[model samples]
Target: MLNDTVSPDFFRKDAAFDELYPEHIRELSQMHWTPIDIARKASDFLAVPNARVLDIGSGVGKFCITAGFYHPETAFYGIEQRGELFSFAEIAKEEVNLSNVAFIHGNLTELRFDDYDHFYFYNPFYENIEPDSRIDYTIRTSFGLYDHYSRLIYQMLDEKPSDTRLVTFHGPDKQVPPSYRLVNNSSYSRVLKMWIKE
Candidate 1:
């Protein structure tokens, strides 16, 4: 069913479309990649017409591409630390020919938090402290880095203007600033949390 053009509807239904990555990467999909349904829900909440949304640790551009498809008016940007993964994200984005989505290969520390209107975080720093959960040994993983990134994110979110939107998936709630109160919580609780700064 797949041809030159990548259809958003096909992507949502076909398992192969979601499994375009290698077996190893595909294996990580369930644990790491955001599901199509979840991405749709998150995108709807984050997309404020022309607002820009940033995925703090966009693994393979799944969240960005899916979000971009549903909300063409909103721009989605992803910051990925791993070079290989970043490359894959670029390739996938090209295949879809979506102008609203872009991927940057760099650490989250290099980005300016103020540039984005909203955020989607999927425990971007979790692999830093947990050796077993690491996607790969390619990047240096340390508790110090985890602590630093967590504190840095907390500070960034704290400084954002009121009404800034954020959606955290599989997060421990430590990285979120106290100033941002939980506006809505899914029955799934920890996995899906919607927050807005006070």
Candidate 2:
């Protein structure tokens, strides 16, 4: 069971929240993880009572954990391909004691989209094309893999039910299906966009 009243202390700033993880994981914050404010805004858009929001390519579980903290009624699930990141995500979630958050150690292609009602994406595939931006060498990175993953996500989103919500932070619009209408975008930056399936 989740606490009825949640504190906003951990979410006060990016630096504060990064303290939940180790030093190395904290160093990857700027490039790899979602900021606290963006996570809150994205969660507000995606959170529906009892809905399950999937964070595609969840790195270190930053987005999922933050979203889960703010929206106790909704569940936030993260699917990470890296085992180290997945393990760290689990540890952070335990420290936060958030029951609404869960992390899966697997690739996005292995998941069944039907299990989730909404999505949060943060340009998880960019590392494939940009060699310097890669998080690590644990996974294979190639332009071919990038196209394959992007196309797979596009197709998956196209098949979701009507009214399904999606939030993309720093993600390209091309990855989203044409059927998903642009609902709105964050005032903070054009990179954060919200969409809904028609």
Candidate 3:
């Protein structure tokens, strides 16, 4: 049962939370998944009650799961293009029993930005440009793909209304549109940054 499998402490740390995944997926936690603390902090900034937050290329649903658990009043949704990663995220979400969180098996291009009030990104397209950092060979990667996705996301963020909130981890400022202003950033969390559209 989920009740038997889950505990308060499970969400407290990265190691304990990552235990929800299988060994192979767990191994990718450090490099790919969002850390628990960073997830919580990002959620705090993005999760306005009754609002929907979208995690772009949410690998294995780490950010969605952790953020949803921390901020139940807000809805957390993740979009992942990889079938294998999406499947694992679904399994983990079921195990966690978090009703406010959801996972979608599709590319970020399939998303409608109007559907969400806030956004979170962990430099999902970086893998395409950084060959050594790629998660797997399941998807094609290239500098072209990275640039395309980055421009697409920049346009998406630009189109959002004023007051839209966004959080990014390990992403460059260039990916963020100039209309969005940097509001808060955590040094301890490294590249964790919060932005607001003006």
**Residue lDDT tens for model 1, 61-107:** 99998888878889999999999999889988887788889999999
By summed lDDT, which 10 consecutive residues of candidate 1 come out lowest?
1-10
Best by TM-score: 2
Which pairs of residues collide in model 3? none
- My TM-score estimates for the predictions, one after another, are 0.92, 0.96, 0.94
Q: Give candidate 2's error at residue 42 in angstroms.
A: 0.2
TM-score for model 2?
0.96
Candidate 1, residue 51: how far the Cα is off, in Å: 0.8
Tell me the tens digit of each residue's lDDT in model 3 across 78-122: 999999999989998998887888999988887778899999999
Q: Give the per-residue Cα lDDT of candidate 1 at 29.
A: 84
Worst 10 residues of 3 by lDDT: 1-10
For every model in order, what is the number of clashing pairs? Answer: 0, 0, 0
**Clashes by residue pair, model 2:** none
Lowest summed lDDT over 10 consecutive residues: which window, candidate 2?
1-10
Candidate 2 displacement at residue 159 in angstroms: 0.5
The deviation in Å at residue 120 for candidate 1 is: 0.4
